[model samples]
Each structure stands twice: as C-alpha cells, then as structure tokens.
Target: GLGPEECMAVNPRLVYGRMTGWGQSGPLAPRAGHDTNYAAVSGALWGCSPADARPVSPFAVLGDIGGGAMYLMTGLLSGIVQARATGRGTVVDAAIVDGSAHMLNLMLSARQSGLVADVRGQSIHDSAPFYDTYVCADGHYVTVGAIEPQFYTLLLQVLGLAEDPDFTGSQWDKAAWPVRRARLAALFLAQPRAHWQALLEPTDACFGVVLSPVEAAQHPHMRARDVYSERQGVLQAAPAPRFDGAAYEPGEACAPGAHTQSVMEGLGQSGARAVWRQR
Candidate 1:
C-alpha cells in the first residue's frame, strides 16, 4: 500500500489504488483474509441461502472481485479524473469489507420500503414461490421470477394453473405462499424439462434453466454472444462490455521481466537494461 503521503511526495498526479479485505485505517486492516471472511463481516453472506440451511459457500466473486477489484478500479478512475483537474494525487483505499457493506445498502433500502422482509425466505426474491427454483420430472431444475401481477398471471396460464383458486389472490399474501408453492411444485414435477420449456420459455415470465458450469458455455445464447474463447488451451470467458460491437482480445499473462527493458528505458534508466540482458 502506498501511504499516500510518501507516494504523493514524488508524483503529485499519482492515482494509487489499494485493495484489501479490511480498510486501511480500520482495526482489522493489517489482518489477512479471503472472500468468505470479508463477506462475513460485510453482511453480504446474510440471506444468501435458505433459512433452514447455512449460507452456501459462494465463489470468490462477491468479495474479491465485486467488492475489492471493482471498487479499486472505480476509485482509481475517479482519482485519475480528479487529479487531472486539481494537479494533486489521490490515494484510494478500496476495501472489500467496506465496499461489500456499502453494497448492502440497496437491500436495506428495500427493507425500509417494505419490499423486502426482515426475515429470510419471505421476500419476493429471497424465497417466494414466484421467484424460486422448481424441479422438473427429468430431475433437472428451472427457475422462475414472475414477480409482477401480469407476468405471474401469464406464468400460471402457461403452467395450466389459470383456474386454481390459490393463485387468484394478492402475491404478497404471506399465508397463501406455501399452498401456492406446493401446487407449483407438483405441476413443475409432472413434466420433463423440455415440456415446460416449450410452454413457459417463450413468455415474459422471467424463466431460466439452472445450468451447470460445463453446460453454461454450450447454451444457445452463450454461443450467440461469443461469451467464451480458448486461449493457451484453456477456455475462458471473453472480456465483457464490448466496444465497437466486439470484445477486446485479451492477451496472455506475461511472465515477470517481460517488459523490464522497455519500462527501464521509459524511466530514463536505459543503462540498467544491460544488467538484466547479461543474465
């Protein structure tokens, strides 16, 4: 971490971005941690799983990439813009514990507005029947998110539940959820995945099939979007948010000292380049 004061002494226009689990000035700043530990403190892990079960172990994306890397990049960009205007350096302390907590404010706002329940497995998106996953006869799973009244009506019509008395009431009625969910579960299990796909997939019902890692890149939409590419014999996702209607081709990871001479020349220390070449 560049202590801001020391780095700014040499270059006033520097945009030094530091990423860590805890913030630079906090009580746990010097401690080492990974995504899980950071998320635990940040409240990102709350309500991420069923109320009966512990929160599932998530990938590193929530804290390491989402909170840490993304925030660091945003901070760096803002600092660079400000430094250009003010001719002074900015030191960005982008911490996962801080940024992830900040991300939870959206949920807090939703709760305050009564859109989200204070308890788990009760909110529209958290565990509601219209927003949860269901299993098909073939043992595969599909998800639904028909939150709006119109879309929920469409979903029921497609699923052959248009005449069911349980689904006719307000969507937010807490007492009706379990009975409604039972009916939905039974209907979803009566047919194979392809059977439901033909009926519900074409509507504005917010439906999706739960795909595995190996099956994700093989989906029609994934193939159409060119979301993945092979590099050095390994298939990985292409860079996102394309410009000019295509992603920028990412280069392979360069080994250490790959650009040592060029960097030294840029620093006006070209004479030191020979020391590396001699080895």
Candidate 2:
C-alpha cells in the first residue's frame, strides 16, 4: 500500500488522508475488520439497541460514514487551509475507532451531569416512556421524543392522558417508567400509526412516524424540498447543505474507470496512457 511519506515526498503541499478501521498504527491496525468491529471497539455500539438485545449495527452510518468519511473530510479541508498558509502539507490519520469514540463526547458529558446513565436500560434516552418508539395496531411504528417537561405534558394532553392518574406524577420518575411505557404501548397499539401521526405530529409532542426510504422520498416535506430524486429507477439523495439557497442537480452516474484517462491527463501525468492501458 502507498504511504503518506511517499506522497508527501513528491508533493509537499499535498494533504494526504488515510482512513482505516483500526488506523495506520496499533496492534489491530493490520487486522481486517468492518464498520461493526470498529464501532464495537470504540464503545459507540454499546449504547445502541435494547438492553436485552445484542447491539444493533447501524447500517454503516455510525462507523463508516459518520466516523470515517466525515472526519477525513474535515481533516483534509483543515490540512489544505494550513498548507496554504504554511506552504507545507500534513497527513490526516482518520481511524473509525478514534472518530467513533470522539462522537460519544456528548453522551459522556450528559453522563457527567447525571442526566444520562451508564446502564443500558436506565438512561433517559433508552428507558423513558416519552422518548421511545411504539408499535401501532397495523404493526407500523411511531417515535416520540418528548424529553422536555413541556413536551411531555403536551404529549399527554394530545393523547388525552393529562387527566389520567397514571401519568400525573413527575415526568422523570424512573420507578414509574415501566408501567407508563406499558400503558403508552397499549394506547398506541389500539390505533394505527396514521392515527397517532394525525393526533400528535402537528403538536409539540416531538412525534414522528417511522418511514422506509421509499416512503421518506414521497413525504410532503421531502417532496417540497426535492430532497430525493430518481434516475434510471434508482433513488438518490440530493446534494445537501445548499449554498446561496441554490438547489443543485446531481450529474448522471458513469461506468467505472470511464474518466481515468482524462483525469490523469488533466494532472499532466506523462504516464497517463500507461495508466489507461492498465485500467
């Protein structure tokens, strides 16, 4: 594999970015692994899933994209800025294990403040009745994140549970969570997901219906913002963080190695023809 020292020797101003599951150095650096292994080692996967269940893999979002690619982008951009000012480049070692652990700072801070707990089923995010998902009569699911007192009150009011004695006490009462969660589950199970969406979504209950990718693309807000587009029967997310409020259309996809010759030639590489031939 090509190393950063070799690249930097050729172009001192190059921002060489390295991404790996275990990083460029360490005992496990040379071991083959995937997103789940990196996340598990970093402790990022521990807080996910129910206490009774095995840790759920977050479909590569947590370790691969969030931990690896995003950090690499930030490092490379910062390195470019510094290189421009100092006329010298730097290597960015973006390891999924390190980046995923860094992403836990918010939860760690909350734990320090006594707002979060180390136990899997005891945290406010995991155990709270007002901050969980419920299955409806149709088997579809909806989520509620009424963590704030006012939002919890609003949720109770919308569900017509404000006057119920079971929910009259303090919202943070951990002793009552199990019973309250059961009650809420029963209530939600009596109706379909659309019923709860209609009753609570427009309110301040912090409610949302669970949706699949196809359903998300067809949602009203997503449609209004043109957040997704279909090309050749493939759905793709639009470019995000728009600049100057301008919506940019994505270019069509191309076959692999289609632009290799052009890209090498643009770099003024004399070996461009050879590279193209190898491809």
Candidate 3:
C-alpha cells in the first residue's frame, strides 16, 4: 500500500487512495486481516447467519468488493475531479472495515422503523415464514420473500394456507412466526422442488428456486437477459448494472505481471522494471 502522505508529497495533485482491511490510522492499521475479520467488526457477518448457526461470510461481497474496491474507486474518481479544479489532491482512506459497517446503516435504519431486529434469524428478512429459504423433497432449496401483505397472502394461498387462522390474521405478529414457519417448512418438504415450482413459479407470490451456478446460467430469465457468458471456455457472470441499457464486454483476464513491461514503458520507467526484477 502507498503511504498516503508520502505519495501526496511526490505528486501534490495525485489522488492517493489506500486500500486496507482497516483504515490507515486505526489501531488495527498495522495488523493483517481477511474478509471475515473485516465483516465481523462491521456487524455485516452477524446478520447473515441463522439464529443458532454461525455467521456466513457471503464470500467477498461485504468486504473486498463492496467495502474496499468499490469505495476506493468512488473516492478516487471524485478526488480526481476535485483535484483538477483546485490543483490540490486528497487522500482517500478506503477501509473494508469502515465500508462494511457503513452498509449496515441500511438495516439499522430498518430497525428504527420496527421492520428489523438486531438479532439474526429474528429479523423479518432472515427467518420469517415467508422470507427465508426452505428445503424441498428433492433436497434442493428455494427462497421466498413475500414481505408485503398482499404478497404474503398470495404465498400462503399458493401453499394452501391462506385460510389458516394462525397464519392469515397475524402476519406481522412475532409470536406466531415459529409455528407458521414450521408448518410452511413441512409443506415445502413434502414434495420435490419440482412440484412446488409447477404450482408457484408463475404466480405473483415472489417465488424463485435457489439455483446453483450451472443451473442459474440455464434458467430462462438468465438465458433471456444474457446474465452469464462464456470466456475462454469458462462460464461466469456478465458485468452488471449495464450502462445506458447496453451490455459491454469486459476485458479478458491476464497473468498478474503480464503488463509490467508495457506499464513501465508508459511511465517512462522502462529500465526500472529490470532493476526491480533483479532485486
């Protein structure tokens, strides 16, 4: 990582962005950490798991991409614009721990509105009867997120539980959630996932199957939208949030140091690469 002040000294107009697990000046700044460690400090890990289970890391979404790179890019771009106008650059301390915690403000705000709980699996979005994943008879999983009253009603109707007094009248009552969840789970587990798909896939019940990568690539919506593409015989997700409603092809991946020579030449330091390689 480039020392923010030291880099700024060399080029006063340079936007110095430091990417780290912790901020540049914090107690943990000198310590090493990974995605899970960053997420744990940010409250992001706690909300992702179930009531009794451990926190799920959600891969590198919360820390590496969401917190570190994305925030750094945004800050660097904005700093570049400002530096151009003022002729003075700035340092952007893009820390994964900071960004991860900042993202929890969304759920924290929901808690203030009485729509979420501080505890995992108690939150409506995590462990609710209509909001969580269920196992089908085929041992496959499916997700349901029928939060709105009308959507919840539709989901229950699809499950043949629309008239059950315990589930029908008190959708928001926390006391009845465990009973409702158990009954709903039983229904889902009674048949193979295909049966539920046939009954609920076309409805406005806010329903969908939890698809693996291969299955996701073959799904109708994914195929129609071109969400996944093959690159060098490898299948992966396409670049997201299309620009102006147009999809753009991404540059191919390359060896880590493949561009070292070209990059050094561009910097008018072509000879420096040989010196560094020797060291």
Cα lDDT tens digits for candidate 2, 221-257: 8899888889877888897779998878877776787
How far off is model 3, as Cα RMSD? 2.3
Q: Rate the local accuracy (lDDT) of all candidates.
A: 0.83, 0.90, 0.85
Residue pairs clashing, model 2: none
Q: Is candidate 1 or candidate 3 better by TM-score?
A: 3
Q: Which residue pairs collide, candidate 3?
A: none
- In terms of TM-score, which candidate is strongest? 2
Clash count of each predicted structure: 0, 0, 0
Reference-based TM-score of each model: 0.87, 0.94, 0.89
If both were scored by TM-score, which would come out higher, candidate 2 or candidate 3?
Answer: 2
lDDT by residue (tens digit), candidate 1, 44-135 = 88777777779854664688888888899999999999988999768899999988888888888888878788777877666688988889
Cα lDDT for residue 149, candidate 3 = 87
* Most lDDT-accurate candidate: 2
